[model samples]
Target chain A: MLEWTRGQAVGEIDTPALILDIAAAERNIRAMADRLIHGSVRLRPHVKTHKCPLLAHKQMAAGAIGVTAAKLGEAEVMIRAGIPEVLVSTPIVGRTKIDRLLALSRHAIVLTVVDDVGAARAISDAATRVGQKIPVLVDVDVGQRRTGVLPGEPALALARQVATMPGLVLVGLQGYEGHLQHVQSRDEREAHWRASMEKLTDTADLIRGAGFPLDIVSTGGTGTSTFALEAPGITEIQPGSYVVMDDHYGTVQGVGFEQALFVLTTVVSRTRTTDVIVDAGMKALSSDSGPPRVRGIEGAQYVFAGDEHGRIEFADQGSNLRVGDRVLLVPSHCDTTINLHDHYHVIEDDRLVEVWPISARGRIR
Target chain B: MLEWTRGQAVGEIDTPALILDIAAAERNIRAMADRLIHGSVRLRPHVKTHKCPLLAHKQMAAGAIGVTAAKLGEAEVMIRAGIPEVLVSTPIVGRTKIDRLLALSRHAIVLTVVDDVGAARAISDAATRVGQKIPVLVDVDVGQRRTGVLPGEPALALARQVATMPGLVLVGLQGYEGHLQHVQSRDEREAHWRASMEKLTDTADLIRGAGFPLDIVSTGGTGTSTFALEAPGITEIQPGSYVVMDDHYGTVQGVGFEQALFVLTTVVSRTRTTDVIVDAGMKALSSDSGPPRVRGIEGAQYVFAGDEHGRIEFADQGSNLRVGDRVLLVPSHCDTTINLHDHYHVIEDDRLVEVWPISARGRIR
Candidate 1:
């Protein structure tokens, strides 16, 4: 998997390469930091989007309190990268993950979210066996009924159990408004975002009112971060995709972040006059959200050609696409797209600056 | 990244693991070999599906003539693993990929398909510079307008040019009917399959009549292997996914291969009485073609919960799913799903077996 080295031109780099614009990404990170500087909420950017320790370090340097990880393997990578604070946002079950989480706690300040008593007890037992006190947050289901308990009583009950559990400290609550992230309208998104935050704060208050220490109230993502900062009790925000905005997030109104990530591909084959094929397909740019949007190619559409190739269809018959021509595509989803590659070709202007290994990539365990 | 070691129970393996049923996959390899043994077309199974050299060796031991790769990186991995013959089915453009392809030709009997003159000239120039005569195939567009020239005079012209070009040998023609691979009805699929072959053979005859020696007429996939074996001029079939069946290809009517690949996951969180959340989501099981199908769990449907979780909705409220229960899911698309993992946990009768590294998993250049 040897790709282009530093000082090579962008066009000279290999096809289907994950290219990150350093300037645009720095601007995105700086803008998010500026937005939350005066607010009560702190930034704890999720590492699952870039999965790069270098980028996570940039986020931490830009005023993030910590980083959020979706898996224990990712947290291990971040902790090995010398990140001091990391919160595993997803619940861990089974002895395998719990053991690994306990091992990770030896090196870093690790916190995990849990929605069930069985998982919480498992973590508590593992932490006790390792002679460590692990922090835990009660994951509350705000709108996305994926992995969380109910907001009010169910969350408070779990928090109470976690607070009393040996070798475990009850931190706060995590109520992610995942469904409200892509609501498509500012008014609708704000209305649902406010309601979701109110539910989270109410649960936080219920847990605090039950004479338990609730130090951290974490929530929000790239879509709901602005509204979540204005909410009453959200102590930190976890916006992952804002650093490398995708085509799906680019459509969200009021997000001033520029698209910073692209899959640089070459026109490999031209079948018809208007239909040119590129070297990137489902393996390069994920089609989970939708097909990636072609950057700066007017009246051109990117379609899935195969698992290893993509078709760029032009509306005009007089298209000038030829073999060896390079094109840029904004991925539909940044998280999954980043998971498919091994390294990122960090570019400044037209030159490759660095090739950072996606340290947490394929760390699904 | 320390997953379950060999000799562990299936339930004890880590969550979100790629599980390969050894017995079922062997049977699938044998079935495809049996179909091609007595026919005019020989089996040249594509390695892009499993991306494992061990599996490619199994296919070769089961009477496959060679292997087909979708990229030069995959061919390099296979050749390094001692697979003697490999045909890169996709066109290789740009200097970086062509240089790699030429380097691979020195180690094995390497071949690649070309649809345009520019790609052919580049391959020819690189092969000449490396002092190697690389085998080339004229990729004819049967129905997939993704990467191929037309199957008439255009293919003959490209074949002639490749034959006369320095350090390049025009060995055959490849016409893959990729669009006809997934037609629902058998009659409709066979109808289009026969037409695609007719076009392929017609192009082969045209190329031969134009004084070019056409040695191989290769085509077909897992969906159209049976029809392609019976096609008049198709001397070899390139079926990749039959060895490790997926949900999308399993729905194809007559492909009798058993589902061999599964994402082994554990129940991490359960929100509702019928809604059980597993540790596999978009990053575990690819949702590109569609959501994965749960194996053996009656009346249960898997839906995308988040990046790290999947919601299993049971039609009946009497669900027995709980935390730490393992479930196996057949991926919608095996190629992209395999790209997300680093190793395959091979299993035999619920006992742990060999853990094969997916050597070419991320070899997408």
Candidate 2:
């Protein structure tokens, strides 16, 4: 357990703590729900960003149809949290992970994505051993060439193979435009998002024309959720970072989500007149995207001090920082930054309301 | 607990696991000890890289004067592990961390680094409340420009203030040249290392001449330990990454440490004929430095697939990869990569010998 308890002041919480603004988070959740209310697409918010069961429940309460997870561990956590519908967004290969995915079918409507025929066969074999039938989505490579098959014939062939395989159901197609999520220009992002959706919808038509059952066309992230909602065939949008927007996602033009997640740190060392050192660093906030933004501290730029400290450089010679002064930092990447901490110090205004455990933290397997 | 037991085969362990080659780790430990035996400088290995008490004990058993930690949480874990001397290398501010640090002093010889007089006074005041005197070292900025005072007058002023404050003992100076650790060229790194040591030694002399007691002059890392061992007035070297050399550290010239740490993963998805996706991604192996290198697999390049997958691209046209095949990955950055895992699957060749818990895995505060 953490040192600070509920009902404590925000300044009284320990340094280098993960802080969550409940008001802002709820606002963001409501905003996403309202945006997709009248559209054909429904929300299946990804739990990979927050990895908290409580947050997943909040998303579900706000009218999310289901939740999307990147790993089997996350799916298991969501299942235990009583989240009935979970789409395992990443492909589950190998005997161990496939067996775990098969076991998850007993508790929830578990759907996994697959790009390879060999992986499809593996899942079918594992499900056959467990006497269960698993629902699978054909992962299509729209633009990002990371982990998906090509859209037209390749996806159709894999769906056809999955249809023939016993103990498996070819449900839908998952085409994620990950590369277009962070484009600086809104017009460019919209253009790329529309093109990727076109590719995904065309491939869905191709698979359905081949006498395969394909209902859900899941896609989009926080950056492209609005565009995906208005698309022709994307039935579900999976946007994770909208709930707790970070500095990186906040920079995307016209994304009206408020920054809700922060790393509360203390100014530990202030030897130089130009810069002060905070207790948060790579261990407290991930720097894979870039350095986090110091929230509400005007003329301050956060720099990577080391693994355990952050250097905040001020524009003025005489700064407002002193030793032990608390500061909030908006992480650059929400998904990786949330993985670094154990608990989220949930705050309402200036008071700590609760400490929620990051249930799926360190669940790499 | 992990899925596999001791003495199990390497193939039986779960995917995306942190594996430690015991033989290679012991050899790396002995290599550092042998290199510093005849020198005036002793080894005070930093436990931030591995963060495992069992590995720290192995280093101390070989030859280590003390252990250096980056946080008070790590110090607490080290103290519980029966490590006699622990020096916290980062400045700890606030009442919560100070109270914990003071409590740790009752069990072991504890030391902390401070750059500002305010932080020095905070530690002194906390120690006074507990009726125990605490030893502190003046942290000098040598070149990192992160958390340290500007070497000569600033460091001397803090040391003098610490000398006047009751319940605080100014015993040493800590000057780390962190920027010179991975300069790529051996000559350039050596030049920077020598200059930083000269600055630290000169600052130590100035503080001692000003009637302040300064004995230990701690400096060095995996890249500059050899140069630090022969530098004049430098009493100890704090190199953490030598025990578990990563891909980034392995690229440095003349650092002959064997790679001991590996993230064991399985091939999960294969969409392209040239690329196969593994289960270890940024969450399994830290990709802040670069993508991890695939070990022993010739003509293979590792690419970041997503948060939970790594796409391994093969140079050869025909590959032998299939679902469930295990692959070893050398992490790009060892410190952050080690923090992402909870256990280290200790292996001796093809056999799993032991499972060591990462006792200080998420001790970031």
The most accurate candidate by lDDT is 1
lDDT by residue for model 2 over A1-365, one digit each (tens)? Answer: 25887799999999899999999999999999999998888999999999999899999999999999988899899899899999999878666677777777887999988888877887898788778889989999899987789999988888888998887988999998988888978999999888888999999999889898788999989998867656888889899999999999888997889999999999988877888888888888888789999888788999987788889999876787898899999899999999988899999988999988999998887
Pick the DockQ winner: 1
Listed for every candidate in order, the interface RMSD values in angstroms are 1.0, 1.4
Identify the runs in model 1 with alpha carbons over 4 angstroms from their true place: none
| Candidate 2 wrongly placed segments (more than 4 Å) | none
lDDT of 1 by residue, B126-183 (tens): 7888688888889999988888999898888788788889978889999888898888
**Across residues B100-121, which tens digit of lDDT does each residue of candidate 2 receive?**
8887899999998988887788
**Which residue pairs in model 2 clash with each other?**
none
